[model samples]
Target: MCLLDKKAFVDFITTLWNIWNYRNNAIFRGKEEDARVIWERARKLNDDFRIHNFSIWSILPWAPKTCKWDVIKLNVDASMKANRTSLGIIARDLDGFVLSGKAIFINRVVNSESAELDAFLEGIWLAQSLNLDKVIFETNYACIINHFCKHKDDITIFGYHIKKARKMLDSCSKVDIKWVDRGCNKVDYSLCNWSLSNCYNLSVEMDYPSDIHNLVISNVI
Candidate 1:
């Protein structure tokens, strides 16, 4: 527990639980479960248990309000330290259930705004990959969202990236980008910071294998 990192720690516990479960099933039910199936099931339960408090928060009166009915929101953030950049993307349904999330790490990228833009684009791609038709992409950094509202030439590298982001947004049929305050987006912000320090890259489908969820509990509480 003290030595292992977050992801490794979560996996260790989940695997233990699954092994105990497999033992009981074999003894009581005389069932022999496949090893691969057991491992997959353990992975699925990782995030479900990791940030179980989030589900509790989802029902809280103070939980961040859903912007529009039936439209999912993707909260994204990024952190840069030295030449390391990390991007975090997390999705929530209208009802506040955490739909999915990702933590990505990149090397040799030093700019903060560039990291922020990268995170925003990753959020968009994740939502699209999930086949979400209507998504409200959000970031806590106001400047990036505000910058997209204007028209600018691709004179510099940042400008070129901005143009690329604009084109990506334009291609989306029903995607909107907005700036939310950081307090409301603490979950992804925590994830981004954690990824920066640990260089952890992860993706969770609705729920699973998200070490960030564990990182999030410390923030919300």
Candidate 2:
């Protein structure tokens, strides 16, 4: 859904929740001042609601307030130089469950920054091959996400990958690239670490992790 639609829907639901909660509170017994205060609070929440339309609360209202995006497509990999260069990419589709793919490129002269760019490029390529036109492309590396959407280009090492990825993206219909908190992208990070340890190219599919799958189901409902 678009940002405006998401925001409007969330505001309506939050207002409903507020009304329901206040109806159950004995303290809300038609006191003019108390009622005014409650109304004001609701109004304030509506304003605050505009700030995070993409948050999980906007979709799964009945789930815990903390529950957020239930499904994610993630790519993880790393690069290093210990007398030799190594790079890898782990692409995962997570929805209440996890499905994954991994790739390793040895002697690639990639650093952490380049690895992140490479992972995103590889993820986009995979998504395109799968015909996932509207999939969300997320990364913990803010710089990479920024670059993906033509925001800024401060990272010099991954210039080639960036250019190649952009050319590839031009052929896709719609791809939403976004920056996510590192904590939320832990699965991808783990895959990256695994690739580094194994020092081999890896690609496979995995079942959706429970938390992510549940989140997806909740959103659909």
lDDT of 2: 0.57
lDDT of 2 by residue, 184-212 (tens): 65555554455556666555555544644
Superposed model 2: Cα runs more than 4 Å off: 1-72, 77-94, 103-109, 151-161, 206-221
> Model 2 TM-score?
0.49
In model 1, the runs with Cα more than 4 Å from the true position are 1-69, 152-160, 209-221
**RMSD after CA superposition, every candidate:** 13.8, 17.7
User: TM-score of model 1 relative to the true fold?
Assistant: 0.59
Model 1 root-mean-square deviation: 13.8
On lDDT, the leading prediction is: 1
Q: For model 1, what is the alpha-carbon lDDT of residue 43? A: 88
Best by TM-score: 1
Q: Write the per-residue lDDT of candidate 1 for residues 17-99, one digit (tens) a residue.
A: 99999999999999999999999999878756655657344433454323343678888998777788888898888655677
